[model samples]
Target: MNGILETILVIVGIIWVIVFLLALFLSPKLSATKSKNGGKK
Candidate 1:
C-alpha cells in the first residue's frame, strides 16, 4: 500500500512538472496574444 501510494505520488509529480514546463514554454505566446487582444478575457 505504501509503495503504491509512493508510485502514484511520483506519477502525479511528474505530470505536474510537465504541465509547469508547458506553461513556461507557452507563457510568452499567451501573453502576446493577451496583449493583442487588449488583455481582455
Candidate 2:
C-alpha cells in the first residue's frame, strides 16, 4: 500500500510539472494574442 501511494505521488508530481511547463511555454503566446486582440483571450 505504501509503495503504491508513493508511485501515485510521483506520477502526480510529474504530471503537475508537465502542466506547469506547458503553461509557462504557452503563456507568452497567449498574452501576445490577448494583447493584440485587446485582451480577448
Candidate 3:
C-alpha cells in the first residue's frame, strides 16, 4: 500500500511540473494573442 501511494505521489508531482512548464511556455504566446485580439481576453 505504501509503495502504491508513493508511486501515485510521484506521478502527481510529475504532472504538476509538466503543467507548470506548459503554462510558463505558453504564457507569452497567450499574451501575444490577447494583444492581437485587442486585449479582449
**Backbone Cα, N, C clashes tallied per candidate:** 0, 0, 0
Flag clash pairs in model 1.
none
Question: In candidate 3, how many Å is residue 35 off?
Answer: 1.2
* Candidate 2 lDDT tens digits, 1-41: 99999999999999999999999999999999999989874
Arranged by lDDT with the best first, the candidates are 3, 1, 2
Give candidate 2's root-mean-square deviation (CA, Å): 1.2
Where does candidate 2 stray beyond 4 Å?
Answer: none
- Candidate 3 per-residue lDDT, tens place, 1-41, comes to 99999999999999999999999999999999999989878
The model with the greatest TM-score is: 3
Which candidate, 2 or 3, has the higher lDDT? 3
* Alpha carbon lDDT at 5, candidate 2: 100
Q: What is the TM-score of each candidate against the true structure?
A: 0.87, 0.87, 0.90
lDDT of each: 0.97, 0.96, 0.98
Spell out the clash pairs found in candidate 3.
none
Using lDDT, give the best candidate's number: 3
Clashes of 3: 0
